[model samples]
Target: MTTSADPREAARTRLSAHREAVLALSHSLHAEPELAFEEHKSAKKIADLMEGAGFAVARGVCDLPTAFTATHGSGDLVIGITAEYDALPGIGHACGHNVNGAAAVAAALALAPVADDLGITVKLLGTPAEEYGGGKVYMLERGAFDDVTAAMMVHAAPVDGLGFTSHAISSWQVAYTGVTAHAAAMPHKGVNAADAMMIAQVAIGAYRQQMIPGGIVHGVVTCGGEAPNVIPGRVTADYDCRAETAEDLAALKARIRACFEAGALATGAELELADVGRDYADLRQDAEFGEAYRRSAEALGRSFDLVPSGMRGGSTDMGNISHVMPTIHPSIGYDCGETIMHNPEFTAYGTTPGADKAVLDGGLAMAWTAIELATAEATRTRLLTAHAERGGRAAGAAAAR
Candidate 1:
């Protein structure tokens, strides 16, 4: 750490200097929304901005066209700030990823000038498909995060929050196939795939009574039938199962699978359960990281007054990254009336003045958090040790394999 007086002040000044560009970036993302791994334009915007700011930019990282890594400084202590830019299908920026991504960009720019002085590396990861593809999980598995010592990101929400952990979730493409016949003439001669789906839904409803606490099952029937006059030959749906932990989610999936199998047994239909993407693990927030973030956010006049409602947060790929490193996933709040996240109505506020302020504050606070992590003795040592231990484990696993 530098001997300068409160280096956070320097980072704050740099953050303010980047204010116009960051807000413009946020509004641009909100204006032009892209989805999942197809976020080519979004990725370019972030990567270009980071490169212009003197960070080394790598595109198409981890074999994902939309994923990239931008780094400043070559210090031993590496702080990773993840930026998400993918939008929801059909709905644009409803989750305020524009705010989230821009804030992360702001943090990286703010920390760049001080990174060398602080003896820390600032890594800005352009993580895509957070809404559906689990890009962070892919990056974590493929070495995008191997050199990162600690990771952090701010989520867009209706209000500020902290220490709110997310659920472990898995999604599946469910299908049932059977023989088809005319409904009016020979309905009794045909095996009904739609009927099988109905049976499975009923079984699921009944099982809900005995379902494990904190379990969530929800999905959409993408294809139910062809016509009312014809007996359906096939039925397809997309469903997600979530639990408090990865192990519990597996158990929940087993029971859910049985219900689907029961549907097939009753109707003699073929059933298929194909996974959609990588499963997201439950988040494990590091205590010291969370505390340091709280102090930083508090100093910025952002209050964490939202009490815990006991409801588990929605799934995020960052949860998988947090399981491996010291990480903090905080909520950078703004006023959006009574609307909730993922609601299209909430999208309207992503470019508002309050949301702009959130961009600056969230980014500056994160930069400050990084400063504290580098300067504070205990957290600095702990994060460094954890990084070394992770490397050792990776080396040992490779040797054994």
Candidate 2:
């Protein structure tokens, strides 16, 4: 006797089978936290799991040591799922990337066995350095997403639902060079680099009032005077500027650069500016993919709280991918209410039972969404049309700019 094909029933069964392995992976990554661009152990652990599950694993992809891709099945519908494992500086696993890595892996595994039956090709891509470096941007440049039809990932948040809009972002480093001399005796002979940086910061602060409503400007002084008594020969700072769209971010960056130049001119210091990380484009959510994910999550008993207009905000490199292809970065709630991400308290709750529930729920929901997009003819047409139209509009807009 043959059984009727029920995707939901199959998904539940598959997820149940791999529950222990997924939880173990999450726990292990949490216990041994690694910093950005240095997730060797975590990467290897995930690769091993994928390889064991019959995926064709490609290690060290995109020239990144901690980056890899695992593919299963060869089908017309190609869907990509991303995993992040890099932790924050001084606060290991604070963002719960361990959960993200494990959940992505579990989702891929659950769908692997039925990929061919569902006429879908599943790819679980391990992207490193998300805490600081824009790993996905690099991978995109290196052609990791060249053939992908769609991509999806889930994020841990304080509340459940589709996450808020993210700002387009640019990361840059600024340095000032001047002559060093004794502060009290030869202050006139020495050009203070720290003074130049201070002036630049002041300029930025003053410029804030003139910026658009959603704009953000923040930075940290990485290097100041070595000692109070000595005039600093060199000073450096890192800054991140954000706006609602890529064009807006580009404009704001130009203005910010002028502020840095102003500091150099006033203090007679030489200024050097370098982009430290990837340029994150503003998020463009695909309506088809977003609705599919919403429906899948709802089917799993998940409810969404649409982010109120003008209230959603953050910065993410995933925005870059969304700009190019159909993508979604839905939030999976863990109810560590009022304890926002990147805090020590949130880190404590990252591995709790609630957090684990988010892992399963998010993974299964994303998997189901992919399945729907791949198998349902109507949904596939919508996805393709949206992608083509968005691509054309984006190209035209870029040409106009």
Find the candidate with the highest TM-score and give its number.
Answer: 1
- Report the Cα lDDT for candidate 2: 0.84
Tens-digit lDDT track of model 2 for 322-369: 877888887787878677889887888878899888889888988888
Each candidate structure's TM-score, on Cα atoms with residue i matched to residue i, is 0.97, 0.93
Winning model by lDDT: 1
What candidate 1 gets wrong by more than 4 Å, as runs, is 309-311
lDDT of 1 by residue, 249-303 (tens): 9999999999999999999999999987799999888878988998999998988
| Predictions in order: lDDT | 0.92, 0.84
